[model samples]
Target chain A: MYKVKVYVTLRESVLDPQGKAVQQSLSSLGYQGVEDVRIGKYMELQFDDSVTDVEGTVKEVCEKLLSNPVIEDYRYEIEESAKQ
Target chain B: MKFAVIVFPGSNCDVDMYHAVKDELGEQVDLVWHDADNLDQYDGILLPGGFSYGDYLRSGAIAHMSKVMAAVKKAAEAGKPVLGVCNGFQILLESGLLPGAMLRNKNLKFLCRTVELSVVNNETMFTSLYEKGEKINIPIAHGEGNYYCDEETLAKLQANNQIAFTYASDVNGSLSDIAGITNEKGNVLGMMPHPERAVDNLLGSADGLKLFQSIVKHWRDSHVVKA
Candidate 1:
């Protein structure tokens, strides 16, 4: 079995309004050193042992569905576990 | 002309689109489900707004994968008029039928109100009835309506006059204050404002009615045979 973890974030050039709001709240709470906050999504997917080319599959999924190439970028890590 | 208003799983504006087409424009129209496989019979296509698929993954992201999107693409390729509004616009961007993508509103809040929009280019089939530079009032309701695109795409859009409308003021943090834009071919338009909601004077403004009229006028002109 393969477990894949994906991280999707807005492109650096794009403004992150939600992240900005969070940063503002943090600053108001006395965390003056919180210079920035960029929010993103984290997802996990599991693949059966029958699937081959796990890396290719994960990349395809992330590009096609997990992250929008226009405004966001995505990266993923895969871990394999032997059948119990 | 016949029109199809595609209804996704969470679409709430399908009926509004149907009413605008049927009662306001007095055209034949149908509400097509997202799972439907064909849009060949429709002369024009409308993708209405709402929280499609509950805005999962992202607004319009999942809904763009609906079975009917293939037909929508075919219709677009065939040069049929396609108008996607709000969430519908998001789906268009997600499907790559339109350039750019939407980001969260700069305020990070769901905005719902009428705003003034300047008609940037009235030459397209969708805006032929409106005078160039005319200011129109359209209702906008969405959380993720801040449109974004890279410099190159923005340059291309400007050069091709694909920008259809711009907010009179900065309503959202969209790059270039873009409220709506058309495909390079000019047959498809994706906009954040809800024109359907402003089609009647009773609804606060009838400024949007001319847009529908424009589409019909253009269609009639082209389909008419000249001797």
Candidate 2:
């Protein structure tokens, strides 16, 4: 079995409103010195032993539909896991 | 004169869009669900603004994989017009219907206010009613409305006149202050404002009504014989 972790975020040059909001909240609570916040998303995909070439397939999915390369960036990691 | 509005699980602006088209154009409109498969009957499709699937993961990430998206793609390929607003814009980015993606607002707040938008391009079917550089007021309500694109693509958009609307002020951190864009064919438009909510003056402003009026007039001009 394989576990695929997908991290999705806006491109570095893009502004992140959610992350900035969270930073403001933290600062309001007296946690200072925080700067340059960026927000992202994480998704996990699990596959069984029958699947082949997990890395290539995940990369293709990310490029084709999972992520929009113009405004967002995505990377994936595979891990060995027990079958369901 | 058939129009359809796609409704995801958590779409709050579907009805507003429905009424906007129905009342303004005096046309029949259908509210299609996200799970529906067939989309051959509609002349146009509108993806209204709202927090789809409660914006799980990303604003439009999960909703991109809905069963109805296949139909949406087919319709788009057939040259039918598709308009995506706010959360709908996010879905268009996720579904690859349009370029770029939505980020959180620069202020990180759920901004809900009337904003000034300047029409950068009026060649699209969506913006044909507005003159180029025309300033209009529309309401924006979203947590993630910022738009980003690479420099090359931005240049391409500028060169091709694909940019439709831009914010008049520095409200959101959109690249080049872009608030809306269209596909290469100008049939698919995705923007980060709620035009449906601005259809009536009683609602707030009526500047956005011209957008829907443009679609109706375009359809008539394309199909109806002028005397």
* Candidate 2 C-alpha lDDT tens digits along B28-109: 8999999899999998999988889998767888888999989999989988889999988899888888877776677667
lDDT (tens digit, per residue) of candidate 2 on A1-84? 999999988778766566777888889988898876777878899988787888888988888766767667898889999756
Per-residue lDDT, model 2, residue B215, is 87
Per-residue error (Å), model 2, residue B9: 0.8
Q: Chain A TM-scores, all candidates?
A: 0.95, 0.89
Report the poorest 10 consecutive residues by lDDT, candidate 2 chain B. Answer: B100-109
| Alpha-carbon TM-score of each model against the true structure | 0.98, 0.88
User: How much native contact recovery, as a fraction, does model 1 achieve?
Assistant: 0.94
Off by over 4 Å in 1: none
- For model 2, give the TM-score of chain B: 0.97
Give the CA lDDT, 0 to 100, for residue A40 in model 2. 81
* Deviation in Å, model 2, residue B41 alpha carbon: 1.4
DockQ score of the complex predicted as candidate 1: 0.94
Q: Best lDDT goes to which candidate?
A: 1
